[model samples]
Target chain A: EPEVTQTPSHQVTQMGQEVILRCVPISNHLYFYWYRQILGQKVEFLVSFYNNEISEKSEIFDDQFSVERPDGSNFTLKIRSTKLEDSAMYFCASTSYRAGNSPLHFGNGTRLTVT
Target chain B: LAKTTQPISMDSYEGQEVNITCSHNNIATNDYITWYQQFPSQGPRFIIQGYKTKVTNEVASLFIPADRKSSTLSLPRVSLSDTAVYYCLVGDDNTNAGKSTFGDGTTLTVKP
Candidate 1:
């Protein structure tokens, strides 16, 4: 089966610095999403993108966060001025159909550590 | 989206059949129940999905009653490798916009 791949499997940065997490979703998928999981915590949805625009975002997705599909296959999440709280495992997911109709394919995840 | 309630943890031995149940009292008519399994440091993997009745796949089985108020995920002859956290999510087909909320999942610990 095709898989979603993420670059920089582990990222370490000082607080207040900027970080960009990159993901390559499965080919032929129309919907893309980003989620984060703090250690020992539930996975939290941050944002969803479709048609090259944001479809929905959670309150956790603040102005400090932005997502871009700079190319047809590359989806990136940029966090401006990362805080210590931003340290978590970031996961990228993609699905061929809308939520509830199809299952999402997720990348292993990028572990981001903000000091 | 509907909120789901599932156990925080469960324990079973190898070769046992494990069933994890989730409750969704406010499930909407258009909502579907989906389950995902996550190993440590890895992303959650889709296990099964169902609206009503029973849906069985190679990995597991999902049972939804007529009311759709609750669902059960059954894994048969579980092994030590089956230990993981299982998440249950409820979402509607009409307006989710590809966003799904995950609550703290049920952690399954399989012993030898």
Candidate 2:
């Protein structure tokens, strides 16, 4: 079975630095999403992408955060200036629309650590 | 999106059956109840989904009442490896916005 793939299983970056998390969604998936979970907190939605454009975003996805599908297969989330609170497990997910039902398939996740 | 209420945690023994119920009193006509499981350091995985009645898959079974206000996830013959956090989400198939809310899930610990 195909699976979503995220690069840099773990990352350590300094505060105020820019970080880009990369993900490769399933080949046939049409919708993609980025979600984050702070340590000991519930997973939070960051953004959703479809047709190479952002479909929805949450308050956490503020000015510093951006998502892009630079290539057909690669989806990325970039943070211009990281804050200490930005440290969390970032997950990439994708899904297919079949019979008007779609279930999210998530990658292992990228653990972002800001110091 | 409909809010869901479920137990915070549960403890079960290996080889026992585990049933976790989630209450969504405000479920809408377009809403579908879906469940996801997450282990530490990993993203949530799709388990089973159901709109109404009982839906069964290889891993678990989902039971929804005629009122559709609540649902249950039943895991049969659980093992230690079945320990994880399970989330119950209520959302619409048209918008897919319901998935955005990942409330605190019910943590299940299966001990030997």
Candidate 3:
């Protein structure tokens, strides 16, 4: 089966540094999403991208966070300034159909660690 | 999005059938109930989804009552490898907009 792939399975960064997480969604998938989970917390939605524009975002996705479909296959999330609380497991997902009926395929996840 | 409530944890033995129930008292007409499973350090994987009645897939079965206020996920002949956290989510699947709210999932531990 095709998979959603994320780069840098683990990343370590200092506070105040900029970090970019990259994801390659499955080809033919139209919708892409980014979600994060703080250790021992529920997975939280960050943003969803469709047609090269942000379709929806959460309060957790603030001014410092942005997502771009840099290419046909690559979706990226950039954080201008990493805070200690920013450390968490970031997941990328894609689906061929809307989330209601078709299921979203998720990547293994990129573990972001901020010091 | 309707709020979902599921158990915090469950314990089962290998070969046993496991059922995890979720409640969504305020489910909407367009809302669909979906379940996802997550292992230790991985992203959530879809298990099954249903709007009403019973829906069965190769991995699990979803049972929704007439009221659609609650649903159940049933895993048959479970094994130790089945241990994982299962999340129940209620949302409108027709729109590409808005994010689904995920609550703390039920952690299932299958023992030998």
Candidate 4:
């Protein structure tokens, strides 16, 4: 089975610094999503991207955050200025069909630590 | 999206069958129930999904009654490795928004 892959399993950055998380979703998937889970908290949806544009985003995905599918294979999430509260495990997921109809394939996740 | 309510935690011994039930009293006609399992420090993995009746996969089985007000995830002969947090989600197929609201999942502790 194909799997989504995330780069830099763990990342550490200073507060107010810019950080980018990269992901490569399954080749055949058409929909992609980003979620974050703070320590001991429920997974929170950040944004969903399709057809090279954002379909939807949550309140947490504010002006400081952006997503780009730079190429056919790489999906990237950029935080303009990292905050201490931004520390969490960021997950990238994709599916061939819409989320409710098809199961999402997720990467191991990238743990971001903001100091 | 329909809200789901499930247990916070459960415990079972190795080699035992375990069932985690979730309640969604206000499920919509177009909603489908889905389950995902998450191991510590890892992303959540899909377990099974069902609209009605019983749906079985290699990993688990999902049983949804005619009313669709509730569902159960049955894992046969669970082992220590089966320990993980299981999430139940209800969503409609027509929604373009890809967000699936994940509530606090039921943590299953498989004891040896």
Candidate 2, residue B4: lDDT: 91
lDDT of model 4, residue B90: 89
Model 3 ranges off by over 4 Å: B94-98
Please identify model 4 stretches exceeding 4 Å from their true place. Answer: none
Which candidate achieves the best TM-score against the true structure? 4
For residue A59, give model 3's deviation from the true position in Å: 0.6
Estimate, for each residue in B4-80, the C-alpha lDDT of model 3 and write its tens digit.
99999999999999999999999989988889999988999988988899999999999999999999999999999
Clashing pairs in 4: none
Q: Quickly count the clashes in candidate 2.
A: 0
Estimate the Cα RMSD of every predicted model relative to the unseen true structure. Answer: 1.0, 1.5, 1.3, 0.9
Q: List the residue pairs that clash in candidate 2.
A: none
Candidate 1 vs candidate 4: the lDDT winner is 4
Q: On a 0 to 100 scale, what is the lDDT of residue B25 in model 2?
A: 99
Indicate the residue-level lDDT of B43 in model 1: 91
Query: Once model 1 is optimally superposed onto the true structure by TM-score, how far is the C-alpha of residue A56 displaced, in angstroms?
Result: 0.7
Tell me how each candidate scores on DockQ against the true complex. 0.68, 0.52, 0.62, 0.66
For candidate 1, report its TM-score: 0.97
lDDT of candidate 2 over A13-91, digit per residue (tens): 9999999999999999888999999999999989888887898888899999999999889999999999999999999
User: What's the true lDDT of residue A33 in model 4?
Assistant: 94
* lDDT by residue for model 4 (A15-110), tens: 999999999999999999999999999999999999999999999999999999999999999999999999999999998987576778889999
Name the candidate, 1 or 4, with the larger DockQ value. 1
DockQ of candidate 3 is 0.62
